[model samples]
Target: MATGLLTSEQAEQIVTTCRTAIGDSLRSVTYFTRDDYEQVYLRNDLERDADLSTFIGHEWRGFKTAQTAYEGSELGDYNYTIRVFDNGFLIRVTNESEGVFATTDGLTVKDFEEVATALNSFLGDREVR
Candidate 1:
Protein backbone atom coordinates (compact mmCIF):
# COMPACT_ATOMS: atom_id res chain seq x y z
CA MET A 1 0.00 0.00 0.00
CA ALA A 2 1.09 3.56 -0.60
CA THR A 3 1.92 5.77 2.36
CA GLY A 4 -1.21 7.47 3.76
CA LEU A 5 -3.45 5.74 1.26
CA LEU A 6 -5.27 3.07 3.20
CA THR A 7 -8.22 1.25 1.71
CA SER A 8 -11.38 1.05 3.81
CA GLU A 9 -10.43 -2.46 4.79
CA GLN A 10 -6.98 -1.40 5.91
CA ALA A 11 -8.35 1.47 7.98
CA GLU A 12 -10.81 -0.86 9.61
CA GLN A 13 -8.03 -3.27 10.42
CA ILE A 14 -5.96 -0.54 11.99
CA VAL A 15 -8.87 0.57 14.13
CA THR A 16 -9.52 -2.95 15.26
CA THR A 17 -5.91 -3.41 16.21
CA CYS A 18 -5.92 -0.21 18.25
CA ARG A 19 -9.08 -1.15 20.11
CA THR A 20 -7.64 -4.52 21.01
CA ALA A 21 -4.40 -2.98 22.23
CA ILE A 22 -5.85 -0.29 24.50
CA GLY A 23 -8.69 -2.37 25.92
CA ASP A 24 -10.07 -0.81 29.10
CA SER A 25 -7.47 1.94 29.33
CA LEU A 26 -9.45 3.69 26.63
CA ARG A 27 -12.68 5.35 27.68
CA SER A 28 -13.86 5.95 24.11
CA VAL A 29 -12.69 5.69 20.53
CA THR A 30 -14.49 6.96 17.43
CA TYR A 31 -13.92 7.29 13.72
CA PHE A 32 -15.15 10.40 11.90
CA THR A 33 -15.50 10.98 8.18
CA ARG A 34 -15.44 14.59 7.19
CA ASP A 35 -15.61 16.20 3.78
CA ASP A 36 -11.85 16.15 3.33
CA TYR A 37 -10.57 14.07 6.20
CA GLU A 38 -11.06 10.83 8.03
CA GLN A 39 -10.08 10.68 11.70
CA VAL A 40 -9.80 8.41 14.68
CA TYR A 41 -10.19 10.05 18.07
CA LEU A 42 -9.48 8.49 21.44
CA ARG A 43 -9.88 9.58 25.04
CA ASN A 44 -8.91 8.26 28.44
CA ASP A 45 -9.30 9.32 32.04
CA LEU A 46 -6.62 10.84 34.29
CA GLU A 47 -6.18 9.06 37.61
CA ARG A 48 -3.36 11.29 38.84
CA ASP A 49 -1.57 14.52 38.06
CA ALA A 50 1.65 12.66 37.38
CA ASP A 51 -0.23 10.83 34.68
CA LEU A 52 -0.58 14.14 32.92
CA SER A 53 3.11 14.95 32.59
CA THR A 54 4.08 11.36 32.05
CA PHE A 55 1.57 10.81 29.31
CA ILE A 56 2.40 14.03 27.52
CA GLY A 57 6.13 13.62 27.74
CA HIS A 58 5.95 10.07 26.48
CA GLU A 59 3.40 10.44 23.68
CA TRP A 60 3.45 13.98 22.33
CA ARG A 61 6.34 15.83 20.77
CA GLY A 62 5.65 19.43 21.93
CA PHE A 63 3.09 22.25 21.78
CA LYS A 64 2.42 23.94 18.46
CA THR A 65 -0.52 26.31 18.01
CA ALA A 66 0.28 26.94 14.38
CA GLN A 67 -0.67 23.43 13.44
CA THR A 68 -3.62 23.32 15.79
CA ALA A 69 -3.65 19.82 14.46
CA TYR A 70 -3.45 17.89 17.71
CA GLU A 71 -4.24 18.98 21.29
CA GLY A 72 -4.65 17.23 24.64
CA SER A 73 -4.98 17.92 28.36
CA GLU A 74 -7.29 17.55 31.34
CA LEU A 75 -10.82 18.55 30.49
CA GLY A 76 -13.02 18.64 33.53
CA ASP A 77 -12.78 15.15 35.07
CA TYR A 78 -11.18 13.48 32.03
CA ASN A 79 -7.88 13.78 30.19
CA TYR A 80 -8.12 13.05 26.47
CA THR A 81 -7.61 13.76 22.77
CA ILE A 82 -5.79 11.39 20.45
CA ARG A 83 -6.61 12.63 16.95
CA VAL A 84 -5.53 10.75 13.81
CA PHE A 85 -5.65 12.43 10.44
CA ASP A 86 -7.62 11.11 7.48
CA ASN A 87 -5.59 12.39 4.56
CA GLY A 88 -2.13 12.47 6.10
CA PHE A 89 -2.67 10.05 8.97
CA LEU A 90 -0.68 12.33 11.21
CA ILE A 91 -1.49 12.11 14.90
CA ARG A 92 -1.97 14.88 17.44
CA VAL A 93 -2.29 14.83 21.21
CA THR A 94 -4.39 17.44 22.95
CA ASN A 95 -5.47 17.84 26.53
CA GLU A 96 -9.09 19.00 26.39
CA SER A 97 -8.55 21.37 29.29
CA GLU A 98 -5.00 22.48 28.45
CA GLY A 99 -4.17 22.59 24.68
CA VAL A 100 -2.21 21.10 21.82
CA PHE A 101 0.88 19.13 22.66
CA ALA A 102 2.24 17.25 19.64
CA THR A 103 1.44 16.20 16.06
CA THR A 104 2.88 13.87 13.40
CA ASP A 105 3.81 14.86 9.86
CA GLY A 106 1.23 13.14 7.59
CA LEU A 107 -0.92 10.08 6.87
CA THR A 108 1.67 7.48 6.01
CA VAL A 109 1.74 3.98 7.48
CA LYS A 110 4.92 5.03 9.25
CA ASP A 111 3.05 7.87 10.91
CA PHE A 112 0.30 5.49 11.92
CA GLU A 113 2.89 3.21 13.50
CA GLU A 114 4.37 6.12 15.42
CA VAL A 115 0.94 7.15 16.68
CA ALA A 116 0.14 3.58 17.65
CA THR A 117 3.41 3.32 19.55
CA ALA A 118 2.82 6.58 21.39
CA LEU A 119 -0.70 5.52 22.30
CA ASN A 120 0.54 2.20 23.63
CA SER A 121 3.32 3.83 25.64
CA PHE A 122 1.15 6.61 27.06
CA LEU A 123 -1.80 4.39 27.85
CA GLY A 124 0.56 1.66 29.08
CA ASP A 125 -1.32 -0.75 26.85
CA ARG A 126 -2.06 -1.41 23.18
CA GLU A 127 -5.16 -0.12 21.36
CA VAL A 128 -5.97 -0.81 17.73
CA ARG A 129 -8.13 2.13 16.65
Candidate 2:
Protein backbone atom coordinates (compact mmCIF):
# COMPACT_ATOMS: atom_id res chain seq x y z
CA MET A 1 0.00 0.00 0.00
CA ALA A 2 1.07 3.52 -0.71
CA THR A 3 0.63 6.50 1.55
CA GLY A 4 0.15 10.05 0.48
CA LEU A 5 2.94 12.53 1.01
CA LEU A 6 3.22 16.23 0.32
CA THR A 7 5.47 17.31 -2.54
CA SER A 8 8.30 19.73 -1.92
CA GLU A 9 6.38 22.56 -3.51
CA GLN A 10 3.27 21.77 -1.50
CA ALA A 11 5.25 21.57 1.70
CA GLU A 12 6.91 24.88 0.97
CA GLN A 13 3.56 26.44 0.25
CA ILE A 14 2.25 25.31 3.62
CA VAL A 15 5.26 26.72 5.44
CA THR A 16 4.96 30.00 3.62
CA THR A 17 1.29 30.19 4.47
CA CYS A 18 1.85 29.51 8.15
CA ARG A 19 4.68 32.05 8.36
CA THR A 20 2.54 34.74 6.83
CA ALA A 21 -0.25 34.19 9.33
CA ILE A 22 2.21 34.39 12.21
CA GLY A 23 3.99 37.31 10.61
CA ASP A 24 0.84 39.39 10.41
CA SER A 25 0.18 38.83 14.09
CA LEU A 26 3.74 39.70 14.89
CA ARG A 27 3.64 42.91 12.88
CA SER A 28 0.55 44.13 14.71
CA VAL A 29 2.36 43.60 18.00
CA THR A 30 5.71 45.19 17.16
CA TYR A 31 7.43 47.71 14.94
CA PHE A 32 10.07 46.64 12.42
CA THR A 33 11.40 47.31 8.94
CA ARG A 34 11.99 44.95 6.10
CA ASP A 35 15.10 44.61 4.01
CA ASP A 36 15.35 44.27 0.22
CA TYR A 37 13.58 40.92 0.41
CA GLU A 38 10.75 42.38 2.51
CA GLN A 39 11.85 40.21 5.42
CA VAL A 40 11.37 41.20 9.04
CA TYR A 41 12.40 39.51 12.25
CA LEU A 42 9.92 38.60 15.00
CA ARG A 43 11.42 38.13 18.41
CA ASN A 44 10.00 35.96 21.17
CA ASP A 45 9.42 37.82 24.41
CA LEU A 46 7.51 35.34 26.52
CA GLU A 47 8.53 34.73 30.12
CA ARG A 48 11.14 32.04 30.69
CA ASP A 49 8.55 29.69 32.21
CA ALA A 50 5.98 30.13 29.45
CA ASP A 51 5.32 27.40 26.92
CA LEU A 52 7.07 28.21 23.66
CA SER A 53 4.91 25.87 21.65
CA THR A 54 1.90 28.08 22.33
CA PHE A 55 3.54 30.88 20.37
CA ILE A 56 5.04 28.95 17.44
CA GLY A 57 2.49 26.18 17.34
CA HIS A 58 3.09 22.40 17.10
CA GLU A 59 4.80 22.40 13.74
CA TRP A 60 8.13 23.72 15.02
CA ARG A 61 9.77 20.36 14.57
CA GLY A 62 10.50 21.34 11.00
CA PHE A 63 13.25 23.78 11.97
CA LYS A 64 14.81 21.78 14.78
CA THR A 65 17.37 19.25 13.66
CA ALA A 66 20.19 17.11 15.05
CA GLN A 67 22.81 18.51 12.66
CA THR A 68 23.34 21.61 14.88
CA ALA A 69 24.06 23.86 11.91
CA TYR A 70 22.59 26.63 14.08
CA GLU A 71 23.02 27.06 17.79
CA GLY A 72 19.96 26.80 20.06
CA SER A 73 19.15 26.69 23.77
CA GLU A 74 16.39 25.34 25.99
CA LEU A 75 14.06 27.54 28.01
CA GLY A 76 11.72 25.62 30.25
CA ASP A 77 10.14 22.80 28.26
CA TYR A 78 10.99 24.22 24.85
CA ASN A 79 14.16 24.60 22.83
CA TYR A 80 14.50 28.00 21.22
CA THR A 81 16.93 29.98 19.09
CA ILE A 82 17.46 33.05 17.02
CA ARG A 83 17.33 32.69 13.25
CA VAL A 84 19.57 35.25 11.65
CA PHE A 85 20.28 35.49 7.98
CA ASP A 86 22.35 37.71 5.72
CA ASN A 87 19.15 39.49 4.75
CA GLY A 88 19.20 41.44 8.03
CA PHE A 89 16.21 39.66 9.55
CA LEU A 90 16.50 37.94 12.91
CA ILE A 91 13.52 35.79 13.90
CA ARG A 92 13.43 34.08 17.29
CA VAL A 93 11.11 31.10 17.14
CA THR A 94 10.88 27.89 19.10
CA ASN A 95 12.76 24.87 17.79
CA GLU A 96 11.59 21.50 18.96
CA SER A 97 11.35 19.05 16.07
CA GLU A 98 12.95 18.59 12.65
CA GLY A 99 11.18 19.17 9.38
CA VAL A 100 11.58 22.08 6.92
CA PHE A 101 12.87 25.60 7.31
CA ALA A 102 12.07 28.21 4.65
CA THR A 103 14.68 30.59 3.29
CA THR A 104 14.13 34.32 3.25
CA ASP A 105 15.57 34.67 -0.22
CA GLY A 106 13.14 34.69 -3.16
CA LEU A 107 10.29 35.47 -0.77
CA THR A 108 8.76 38.92 -0.67
CA VAL A 109 6.36 40.55 1.76
CA LYS A 110 3.60 40.36 -0.81
CA ASP A 111 4.27 36.67 -1.24
CA PHE A 112 4.16 36.19 2.49
CA GLU A 113 0.84 38.00 2.72
CA GLU A 114 -0.62 35.92 -0.07
CA VAL A 115 0.55 32.69 1.53
CA ALA A 116 -0.95 33.70 4.86
CA THR A 117 -4.23 34.64 3.28
CA ALA A 118 -4.37 31.39 1.39
CA LEU A 119 -3.68 29.37 4.52
CA ASN A 120 -6.36 31.19 6.42
CA SER A 121 -8.86 30.60 3.65
CA PHE A 122 -7.92 26.96 3.36
CA LEU A 123 -8.32 26.32 7.04
CA GLY A 124 -11.60 28.20 7.15
CA ASP A 125 -12.96 26.04 4.39
CA ARG A 126 -11.93 22.81 6.02
CA GLU A 127 -13.58 20.83 8.78
CA VAL A 128 -11.38 20.15 11.73
CA ARG A 129 -12.07 17.13 13.87
Candidate 3:
Protein backbone atom coordinates (compact mmCIF):
# COMPACT_ATOMS: atom_id res chain seq x y z
CA MET A 1 0.00 0.00 0.00
CA ALA A 2 2.71 2.38 -0.89
CA THR A 3 1.80 5.79 -2.26
CA GLY A 4 0.05 5.31 -5.58
CA LEU A 5 0.37 1.54 -5.38
CA LEU A 6 -3.32 0.70 -5.26
CA THR A 7 -4.57 -2.46 -6.82
CA SER A 8 -7.32 -2.22 -9.41
CA GLU A 9 -9.99 -3.08 -6.85
CA GLN A 10 -8.58 -0.72 -4.29
CA ALA A 11 -8.36 2.09 -6.78
CA GLU A 12 -12.00 1.53 -7.73
CA GLN A 13 -13.07 1.61 -4.12
CA ILE A 14 -11.09 4.78 -3.44
CA VAL A 15 -12.53 6.45 -6.49
CA THR A 16 -16.02 5.39 -5.50
CA THR A 17 -15.54 6.72 -2.00
CA CYS A 18 -14.14 9.96 -3.34
CA ARG A 19 -17.05 10.30 -5.71
CA THR A 20 -19.50 9.70 -2.89
CA ALA A 21 -17.70 12.25 -0.73
CA ILE A 22 -18.21 14.79 -3.48
CA GLY A 23 -21.92 13.90 -3.30
CA ASP A 24 -24.39 15.41 -5.73
CA SER A 25 -21.79 17.64 -7.26
CA LEU A 26 -21.12 14.93 -9.79
CA ARG A 27 -23.86 13.64 -12.05
CA SER A 28 -22.40 10.17 -12.34
CA VAL A 29 -19.24 8.09 -12.07
CA THR A 30 -18.32 5.34 -14.47
CA TYR A 31 -15.73 2.81 -13.43
CA PHE A 32 -13.73 0.65 -15.75
CA THR A 33 -10.34 -0.88 -16.46
CA ARG A 34 -7.91 -0.57 -19.34
CA ASP A 35 -4.87 -2.31 -20.69
CA ASP A 36 -2.15 -0.23 -19.08
CA TYR A 37 -4.29 1.24 -16.33
CA GLU A 38 -5.92 -0.86 -13.66
CA GLN A 39 -8.96 1.33 -13.05
CA VAL A 40 -10.56 4.62 -14.08
CA TYR A 41 -13.36 6.78 -12.80
CA LEU A 42 -15.13 9.06 -15.24
CA ARG A 43 -17.00 11.72 -13.30
CA ASN A 44 -19.70 13.59 -15.10
CA ASP A 45 -21.60 16.81 -14.28
CA LEU A 46 -18.76 18.31 -12.28
CA GLU A 47 -20.08 21.81 -12.78
CA ARG A 48 -21.97 23.73 -15.40
CA ASP A 49 -19.07 23.26 -17.81
CA ALA A 50 -16.77 20.39 -16.93
CA ASP A 51 -16.39 16.80 -15.91
CA LEU A 52 -13.58 15.27 -13.87
CA SER A 53 -11.81 11.99 -14.49
CA THR A 54 -9.39 9.86 -12.42
CA PHE A 55 -7.43 6.89 -13.64
CA ILE A 56 -4.96 4.59 -11.89
CA GLY A 57 -2.02 2.76 -13.41
CA HIS A 58 0.80 0.67 -11.97
CA GLU A 59 3.90 -0.89 -13.44
CA TRP A 60 7.28 -2.14 -12.30
CA ARG A 61 10.17 -0.76 -14.32
CA GLY A 62 12.94 -3.21 -13.49
CA PHE A 63 13.17 -3.12 -9.69
CA LYS A 64 11.27 0.12 -9.25
CA THR A 65 7.48 0.16 -9.21
CA ALA A 66 5.44 3.15 -10.30
CA GLN A 67 1.83 3.77 -9.40
CA THR A 68 -0.01 6.94 -10.33
CA ALA A 69 -3.34 8.67 -10.59
CA TYR A 70 -3.98 10.63 -13.74
CA GLU A 71 -6.72 13.15 -12.99
CA GLY A 72 -8.08 15.81 -15.36
CA SER A 73 -11.00 18.20 -15.39
CA GLU A 74 -11.95 21.81 -14.91
CA LEU A 75 -11.97 23.60 -11.58
CA GLY A 76 -13.75 26.51 -13.22
CA ASP A 77 -13.80 27.82 -16.73
CA TYR A 78 -10.12 26.93 -16.82
CA ASN A 79 -9.18 23.28 -17.22
CA TYR A 80 -6.80 21.43 -14.91
CA THR A 81 -4.88 18.19 -14.75
CA ILE A 82 -3.46 16.61 -11.62
CA ARG A 83 -0.99 13.79 -11.64
CA VAL A 84 -0.54 11.99 -8.33
CA PHE A 85 2.55 9.85 -8.25
CA ASP A 86 4.08 7.74 -5.53
CA ASN A 87 5.55 9.95 -2.76
CA GLY A 88 4.57 13.20 -4.59
CA PHE A 89 1.99 14.77 -6.85
CA LEU A 90 1.49 17.73 -9.22
CA ILE A 91 -1.43 19.91 -10.31
CA ARG A 92 -1.64 22.08 -13.40
CA VAL A 93 -4.37 24.44 -14.55
CA THR A 94 -4.96 25.43 -18.15
CA ASN A 95 -7.14 27.76 -20.19
CA GLU A 96 -7.25 25.57 -23.25
CA SER A 97 -9.37 22.44 -23.23
CA GLU A 98 -8.66 19.14 -24.92
CA GLY A 99 -12.46 19.07 -25.41
CA VAL A 100 -12.97 17.20 -22.12
CA PHE A 101 -14.58 19.99 -20.15
CA ALA A 102 -18.31 19.62 -19.75
CA THR A 103 -20.75 22.48 -19.09
CA THR A 104 -20.61 23.05 -15.34
CA ASP A 105 -18.10 24.21 -12.72
CA GLY A 106 -19.28 22.86 -9.40
CA LEU A 107 -16.20 20.88 -8.47
CA THR A 108 -14.04 22.91 -6.10
CA VAL A 109 -10.43 22.72 -5.05
CA LYS A 110 -11.44 21.91 -1.49
CA ASP A 111 -13.55 19.01 -2.63
CA PHE A 112 -10.80 17.65 -4.83
CA GLU A 113 -8.25 18.01 -2.05
CA GLU A 114 -10.45 16.16 0.38
CA VAL A 115 -10.59 13.18 -1.94
CA ALA A 116 -6.91 13.30 -2.75
CA THR A 117 -6.02 13.61 0.90
CA ALA A 118 -8.12 10.60 1.73
CA LEU A 119 -6.36 8.56 -0.91
CA ASN A 120 -2.93 9.69 0.22
CA SER A 121 -3.76 8.94 3.81
CA PHE A 122 -4.92 5.48 2.90
CA LEU A 123 -1.69 4.87 1.05
CA GLY A 124 0.47 6.21 3.84
CA ASP A 125 -0.60 3.58 6.33
CA ARG A 126 0.17 0.53 4.24
CA GLU A 127 3.51 -1.17 3.60
CA VAL A 128 5.22 -0.34 0.33
CA ARG A 129 4.92 -3.04 -2.24
Candidate 4:
Protein backbone atom coordinates (compact mmCIF):
# COMPACT_ATOMS: atom_id res chain seq x y z
CA MET A 1 0.00 0.00 0.00
CA ALA A 2 1.16 3.51 -0.79
CA THR A 3 1.53 5.76 2.18
CA GLY A 4 0.84 8.80 -0.01
CA LEU A 5 3.73 10.50 1.76
CA LEU A 6 7.44 10.56 1.22
CA THR A 7 8.26 6.86 1.11
CA SER A 8 11.24 4.77 0.08
CA GLU A 9 9.57 3.87 -3.21
CA GLN A 10 9.06 7.53 -4.01
CA ALA A 11 12.66 8.22 -3.10
CA GLU A 12 13.80 5.51 -5.46
CA GLN A 13 11.71 6.94 -8.26
CA ILE A 14 12.99 10.43 -7.67
CA VAL A 15 16.60 9.32 -7.56
CA THR A 16 16.16 7.13 -10.63
CA THR A 17 14.65 10.00 -12.57
CA CYS A 18 17.44 12.25 -11.44
CA ARG A 19 20.03 9.73 -12.58
CA THR A 20 18.28 9.54 -15.92
CA ALA A 21 18.32 13.29 -16.31
CA ILE A 22 21.92 13.59 -15.19
CA GLY A 23 22.92 10.72 -17.49
CA ASP A 24 26.64 9.89 -17.41
CA SER A 25 27.30 12.53 -14.79
CA LEU A 26 25.70 10.38 -12.13
CA ARG A 27 28.28 8.61 -9.99
CA SER A 28 26.34 6.83 -7.30
CA VAL A 29 23.09 6.63 -5.35
CA THR A 30 23.09 6.22 -1.56
CA TYR A 31 19.96 5.28 0.29
CA PHE A 32 19.50 5.51 4.05
CA THR A 33 16.90 2.91 4.77
CA ARG A 34 16.66 3.71 8.46
CA ASP A 35 16.29 7.43 7.90
CA ASP A 36 14.16 7.12 4.79
CA TYR A 37 16.27 9.45 2.67
CA GLU A 38 18.37 9.25 -0.50
CA GLN A 39 21.52 10.81 -1.84
CA VAL A 40 22.13 11.15 -5.55
CA TYR A 41 25.75 11.90 -6.24
CA LEU A 42 27.41 12.85 -9.50
CA ARG A 43 30.87 13.29 -10.86
CA ASN A 44 32.38 14.56 -14.12
CA ASP A 45 35.89 13.29 -13.63
CA LEU A 46 36.40 11.99 -17.15
CA GLU A 47 35.22 15.13 -18.95
CA ARG A 48 36.33 17.80 -16.51
CA ASP A 49 39.68 18.52 -14.99
CA ALA A 50 40.36 16.99 -11.61
CA ASP A 51 40.92 20.40 -9.99
CA LEU A 52 37.50 21.60 -11.14
CA SER A 53 35.63 18.72 -9.58
CA THR A 54 34.12 20.73 -6.75
CA PHE A 55 32.43 23.38 -8.88
CA ILE A 56 31.44 20.86 -11.53
CA GLY A 57 29.23 18.67 -9.40
CA HIS A 58 27.54 17.90 -6.09
CA GLU A 59 25.09 15.55 -4.35
CA TRP A 60 21.33 15.56 -3.72
CA ARG A 61 19.60 14.40 -0.56
CA GLY A 62 15.84 14.10 -0.31
CA PHE A 63 13.72 13.29 2.72
CA LYS A 64 10.25 13.47 4.11
CA THR A 65 10.51 17.00 5.47
CA ALA A 66 7.75 16.18 7.92
CA GLN A 67 9.58 13.29 9.51
CA THR A 68 13.10 14.63 9.47
CA ALA A 69 14.36 17.03 12.07
CA TYR A 70 16.01 20.17 10.81
CA GLU A 71 17.85 22.59 13.07
CA GLY A 72 16.50 20.66 16.01
CA SER A 73 12.87 21.08 14.99
CA GLU A 74 10.47 19.22 12.75
CA LEU A 75 8.63 21.58 10.45
CA GLY A 76 6.58 18.98 8.66
CA ASP A 77 7.76 19.95 5.20
CA TYR A 78 9.19 18.13 2.19
CA ASN A 79 12.59 19.31 0.99
CA TYR A 80 16.09 18.35 -0.14
CA THR A 81 19.68 19.40 0.33
CA ILE A 82 22.53 19.85 -2.09
CA ARG A 83 25.99 19.39 -0.67
CA VAL A 84 28.25 21.54 -2.85
CA PHE A 85 31.99 21.72 -2.79
CA ASP A 86 33.83 24.64 -4.23
CA ASN A 87 37.49 23.72 -3.73
CA GLY A 88 37.63 20.08 -2.68
CA PHE A 89 35.77 17.30 -0.92
CA LEU A 90 38.18 16.94 1.98
CA ILE A 91 36.83 20.02 3.69
CA ARG A 92 34.99 19.53 6.92
CA VAL A 93 31.35 20.47 7.39
CA THR A 94 32.20 22.84 10.24
CA ASN A 95 35.04 24.52 8.38
CA GLU A 96 33.94 28.04 7.48
CA SER A 97 36.84 28.63 5.12
CA GLU A 98 35.89 25.84 2.74
CA GLY A 99 33.56 28.28 0.93
CA VAL A 100 31.11 25.45 0.47
CA PHE A 101 27.50 26.47 0.19
CA ALA A 102 24.77 23.88 0.58
CA THR A 103 21.74 24.65 -1.51
CA THR A 104 19.36 23.17 -4.07
CA ASP A 105 21.63 22.23 -6.95
CA GLY A 106 20.26 18.78 -7.76
CA LEU A 107 17.68 19.96 -10.26
CA THR A 108 17.32 23.35 -11.84
CA VAL A 109 14.62 25.72 -10.63
CA LYS A 110 12.40 25.01 -13.63
CA ASP A 111 12.79 21.26 -13.25
CA PHE A 112 11.99 21.37 -9.56
CA GLU A 113 8.88 23.36 -10.27
CA GLU A 114 7.83 20.88 -12.91
CA VAL A 115 8.28 18.07 -10.44
CA ALA A 116 6.16 19.86 -7.89
CA THR A 117 3.47 20.29 -10.48
CA ALA A 118 3.57 16.62 -11.33
CA LEU A 119 3.27 15.64 -7.69
CA ASN A 120 0.27 17.90 -7.29
CA SER A 121 -1.28 16.37 -10.38
CA PHE A 122 -0.67 12.91 -8.94
CA LEU A 123 -2.68 13.82 -5.87
CA GLY A 124 -5.71 14.37 -8.05
CA ASP A 125 -5.07 11.34 -10.18
CA ARG A 126 -4.54 8.93 -7.30
CA GLU A 127 -7.34 6.40 -7.00
CA VAL A 128 -8.45 5.26 -3.55
CA ARG A 129 -8.49 1.59 -2.82
* Top TM-score model: 3
* Cα lDDT over the full model 1: 0.37
lDDT of each: 0.37, 0.34, 0.36, 0.34
lDDT of 3 by residue, 67-115 (tens): 1222233333222344444533333211111111111125566766665
Of candidate 3, the 10-residue stretch with the lowest lDDT total is 95-104
**Residues 9-107, model 2: lDDT tens digits:** 544455455466445333211111111011112235422342333333322433344225444545233332334456432233321212222233334
Q: Candidate 2: what lDDT?
A: 0.34
Error of 1 at 108 (Å): 26
TM-score of 1: 0.25
Full candidate order by TM-score, most accurate first: 3, 4, 2, 1
Judge candidate 4 against the unseen true structure and give its global Cα lDDT, from 0 to 1: 0.34
- Candidate 4 residue-wise lDDT, 102-121, digit = tens: 12234454554444444334
TM-score of each model, in listed order: 0.25, 0.27, 0.35, 0.30
The Cα error of candidate 1 at residue 75, in Å, is 26
Candidate 1, superposed: residue stretches over 4 Å from native: 1-6, 27-35, 39-115, 118-129
